[model samples]
Target: MKHKQAGLSLIGLLIVAVLLAFVFLIGMRTVPVVTEYFAVKKIIHAIAASNPSMDETTADIRRDFDKRASAEYVDSVTGQDLAVYKHGGQFEIGIEYSRKIPIVANVSLLLEFQTDAKSNGGR
Candidate 1:
């Protein structure tokens, strides 16, 4: 009679461990960037929502965005980077930015983020 053992070999286990480690490392690098993106999006949405009357000037909007972005520790995209315009009687605010995260020697991950929100619609 022959019996077969079903389990991961040592080499297979090591390979799995290495792959998991790499995945974890990439995830760790990615989380903060994503967090910041969401924070920026929230800030823009809040600003737009609060000024639904569309009475605020573009300069005023930019200034408000700068203040809130600073508070949120979002330095990648500034108020100057925003695209502010009026459409359908609503203020539309948007931002596009790219972030580069270095993962290893001479290797990096680049991420692009864009968000647009209207004053009346909550996102």
Candidate 2:
């Protein structure tokens, strides 16, 4: 009688390890994007809370949002704009940010996100 042990082959183990490594890398890369998105959301909420007097246009809010985000990430934040609209007495403010993620030389991932908040004259 003879007994033999079976185990994962080198290639099989290597493949599993590579797959795990890839998942970890993707998660790491996504963390910053998620963080930036949340930060933008917070900024939008703050702007809405402040409830700056509604002006003839949304330029002031846009500039203020850009200034805040820019100060937070002077070197990273790019493409700042505002998407604003009003509904009767309520106003909705949307802060948008477009950023480029460098994946390789001259290759980037264009990531953009917007956050919207509504204000009812501080009610």
Write down the lDDT of every candidate, Cα atoms only.
0.89, 0.72
lDDT tens readout by residue for model 1, 1-123: 999999999999999999999999999999999999999999999988786555667888889999999999997888899999987678899998899999999999999999988887322
Residue 41 of model 1, lDDT score: 93
Measured over all alpha carbons after superposition, the RMSD of each candidate to the real structure, in angstroms, is: 2.8, 3.5
lDDT of 1 at 54: 56
Give the alpha carbon lDDT tens digit for every residue of 1-123 in model 2. 797878999999999999899778767786788787887787778877876665635777777778878866633443245677777766688756777766547866777776789876734
Backbone collisions counted per model: 0, 0
Q: Would you estimate the TM-scores of all the predictions?
A: 0.88, 0.71
